[model samples]
Target: MTHTLNQPRNSTKSSSFRVDLQGLRALAVLLVMCYHIWFSKVSGGVDIFLMLSAFFLTSSTARRISRGERPPLITGWLHRFSRLIPQAAVVIVSVVVAAWIILPSTRWLELIDQSKASLFYQQNWYLANHQVDYYAFNTSSASPLQHFWSLSVQGQIFILWPVVLAFSVLIWKLFFSRFNFAWVAGAFFSAVFIGSLAFSINITANNQQVAYFHTGARLWEFALGSLLALALPWLSTLPEKIRRIAGWAGMITIVASGAVLDVQGQFPGFMALIPTMAAALIIAAPATRAWANPSGVLSLKPLVKLGDLSYGMYLWHWPMLVFYLEVSGNQKASFLAGTLLIAASIAASWCTTRFVEKPVIAWQNNLAFPHWMPSTGLKAISQIAVVAIGLGIASLSVTAWENNVEHRRALAASQTATDNPGATAPEDWDPAPAALTLPLATELADEWQTPGNPCAGSNNPDDERIMFCEQGGNFDGSPDLVMLGDSHMQHWSAAAAAAMEESGGSWILVFHPGCRYGSDADRDEAECANFQDAAEEYVADLAPKMVLTTASKTVAAPDEYLRSPGEQETIVDHYAEAIQPFLDAGSQVIAMRDTPRYTYSIPECVDSNPSHLEACDGSAHEALAQINPVQEFLAQHDYGQQVVSLDMTGLLCPEGVCKAVIGNVSTYLDDSHLSKTFVLSAKRQFAEAFKKATGWQ
Candidate 1:
């Protein structure tokens, strides 16, 4: 539930009474809470809140402008944002402090970054631009503020909507004064509604992940509500029976939207009309005493009160769920635990709304110091100024403190010698060296260097290309070697670049996230199949002497492992089929064995238990399949004697033990991929294998 906008009840001409809107707010927030905590599904409740906010905002602005009583733009903005920022700032501050106290240091940087983004209401853009998988169900470990993406969208619209209304007012006065200001504004908003809807549909189809948080993609929802605000007068004049039916239909639609629609994949698109239109119908419906009236159902006292606390409820529920998941160490809690969490969140929301939100509202209303000030605007600005300054200072202080911690770690790293240096694997060596320090792990975790990766820009999963040319590779007059596979291969790009530099060769990397070198059938998606085909064709054309790639892949489920007899044969066949084109074009294939894939984050584990590093280490047998899947595959498949299978597992997991640190270097960056620093340390061994495979000597 990315979240909402606030509005005064009498803002719209026909919405003089808004008990129904408040009830709708209650319904929307509850659906979001239920979906987030237990269902892990999208509820389209957020779309309704977004629409309602725009309706209120546009109607209020239109009323002010139509009356020729425009308040100072800055005053209006400061007042609106002041009301919004206080509770959000408190939540952010509480979350930051709580995360620091409870979460691992490895998660601190990201949490802090998001906490800051949440406060400034830019988290949606940050999440979208960073390509964060916002729907990922990492309840225990994911950022609590991830849900703020929706709130950030609403906040941005809050800032811009007024400006748009102001511009429309200027246009109406200048060229269309004869027409009603509300109607003139409606025409402009209608145009925006249609144009934004078209863009939203096109973009969501192409990249739904980014589209989910994109401001441009969501503007149509807001515009739709704004247009509805203008249409309210006519809508209220509809026959009594039709209005009652419309209200009932809207209510039922809002309740059922989550269960019926595929919101996650097709949201903010044409499908979004289900909830937004439901909300519009309800908002348009005139009040009635009849039981069939949606307004009657929504205006119940308890529901109306819940609506009053909806903003705070929305704010508190996600963080509470996340905190519950983290503290309990459970992915999904029992029904009882979820109920407790919801109860706790509701209590917290009530406290926030009653003690924090209402008081601020009262205080802003009571201000009398600025006699020149027209209304609550000055008081709101004053409150915002204080909160902004305090938050800014707090953020700077936290940043400085975190920087100091890193600085100390860097200094320690510089003074010490890396114990293992990862020179060679030994049978009897302790994976953790006495001289190896925590700083080394931090350094290694930070050093996942990749060179010439094509998915470096704004390319989302489907748009990622397979080919990436090394810097100066085309003009360096060096022999070309092509590297390919998934993240496993991409992780070794820096080391491969180093080896090529020494061998007077350059490399091109052809990689995709989960698409390793395998047959089209083994590929995860159509995009992966396309990438595999294109990469094979590209490599054949280049006619490189060697095609370097990795054969190690890890599955999250234990049942998915290739442990049975002849299981590795399937892997071999798939790999051979995928790489046959390259081999057919006279290129040698060198497949490196994968590193150990850990169950949890090695850096995070190490960070949490610095003194007991051994606890972070795992059984090598469990981490790796008994048979090297690739080696077993290659044993039977003949690509002449040119295809070389290399298992340097010994270099990484010496003596059947995969530890967090090796030779003073962090072995794995996250769970499976080798840290760039560790890989670079093993460059001598890598080069030796390369020479043997390519016959480069």
Candidate 2:
């Protein structure tokens, strides 16, 4: 992703302009644009860019070290970053301003965060931690800055590879003076290649989403390039006929790999070898006129010129595509629109390269400091420091704006708490008017509730599978109440905590995000199955006075018909079997009916359609089954004495419609999860329902 337009200062004539390599860069960028704009798939182009960066970097550093010349570790980084930062800064600032103007207000804070991450070269880690699926193909919801992830990885390696080379040089001079430095470096990189590739394969198999953005998983690709650079001299000795075959083969493979392979799912792993090694072959291939080679096609002037704009084009293309999708309201662009997007991206790239990148590079190269500044390295450092300060100012401004927005949202929530009665309001009650909906769109991300404290002492489950948390009352012994299940149960934690506090009893929360509490054999997901087994075992052994969980699962509207009688029986049978363990332990079961699931995010829908709130409403009859599954299960079984089914359908949906905004509070955070604000507003209702179900004072 980082384009090395200029060779290292120690470059030999052999390292001079290679039209084929430039053309390779152009092809890589073009493939990336084509796949992203039209195909919605990974092209493996960024992997080629990463490998080529290491190819160039290692080629330069190893040459210097071999000649007994000290590598400019400090000044080199300063120079490289100083050249790179100006264009990146311009793109980031432009994206931020554009996002504020064009994107929904709900996305502004997230954009600010990603912009900072991108500017500081930490975007890959940020996205990885968030578990963003790079191949989601949801352009409307995708971040315009997501493509910066690859660039961030490149930036990190640019810093790291140099230190690695410097250390290799030190070891070579001290311990392995008899051995060639390239041999030593190659040996070290070989170990990196093997170890990192193994790790990449393991992690990718376990979690492809995280592996895609993981730096350590990607280190092997760069190491392979380093190895190729070290072996170039030996490779050039091949016959011209063989080199031509390899060159054409590599070029053909690089172009065909994206179309044939599942790059998105399998990359940064062994599958990455296909394109990266193909690139390696091209890099090692001879480009003479004595024999036909891929260079005949790749060395064309227009393609070579496109390579000049590759870096800028990479930066411009994604944002243009994302914004185009947003403005046009299309899932995927038409071929004509995609072509125009590519053209606009190329033009923008040209402008940035011409007006921003070239000027900065020229200024840095021609820097003439005062006599007092003795070292050119110091002048380079000064330039880098100026860029750093500019980035710092921009980051601080964004942080201040984010803080102000959060403060205003918090103040508005507090002021309207009384007006927004939420689920506790009577069906016929008319609420007071408010300026903004409760849990404002800007604050929706924080709507998922948590217990705010992890379980401790005897209350904490020994099994790690149970994501245990504690709230309410003093933790002296076992919890008086236990809440178990997935996120559907998590949303009720606040209300449960309030009830426990009022009753002077402690409660433990045992949750796994998407896993329901039931028989492990019934679940298909291995992790969720394991979590369910552990949670059931932990809760049954602890034997709390009461256990709470979701009694049924709601499907999104349009597919919301009630289950068949046999399906209902099977569902309740699982619940009854799961609940029998708690009943045998002398714990009462409170099975609350699941909340309505919508086809779209409630908060987002409400945010975008505030004037026509009814458009965001859903059919209550369709949202919930005709008969409560829990009630049917109780009637069909003999557990009614201990198992109590609590249905809040009337509270959630009034007049046969499930309104997104109830009593001025945004009911659901996303499509299925209830907003914490709405849940907390329903605390009194929850407490009253608990009293009625248990006959507790």
Question: Which model scores highest in TM-score?
Answer: 2
* Tens-digit lDDT string for candidate 2 (1-697): 1236322222222435466777788899999999999999988889999898898888877767767788767776876777677667778877876776677667777788898899989999999999999999774469999999998998899899989998888898899989988899999899999999999999999999999999999999999999998998899898877877887898899999889999878887899999998988888888653337777677777887788778888988999888889888799989999999999988997888788767766665567777787767667677677578658756765676678677767767577455777776666876655556788777777887885487767776877776556655765566778898888889889988888878877888888887777734337888888888888888889888889988786656342364532232224227777887899999999887877777677777787787888899987766677777778777877775588887777777877888888887888888888889898988888888888887655
Q: RMSD for each model, in Å, please?
A: 5.3, 4.5
**For model 1, how does the per-residue alpha-carbon lDDT over 296-341 read when each residue is reduced to its tens digit?**
8887878777877788888888887787787777888688987887
- How many pairs of residues collide in each model? 3, 0
The C-alpha lDDT values of all candidates are 0.73, 0.80
Q: Assess every candidate by TM-score.
A: 0.83, 0.85
- Model number with the top lDDT: 2
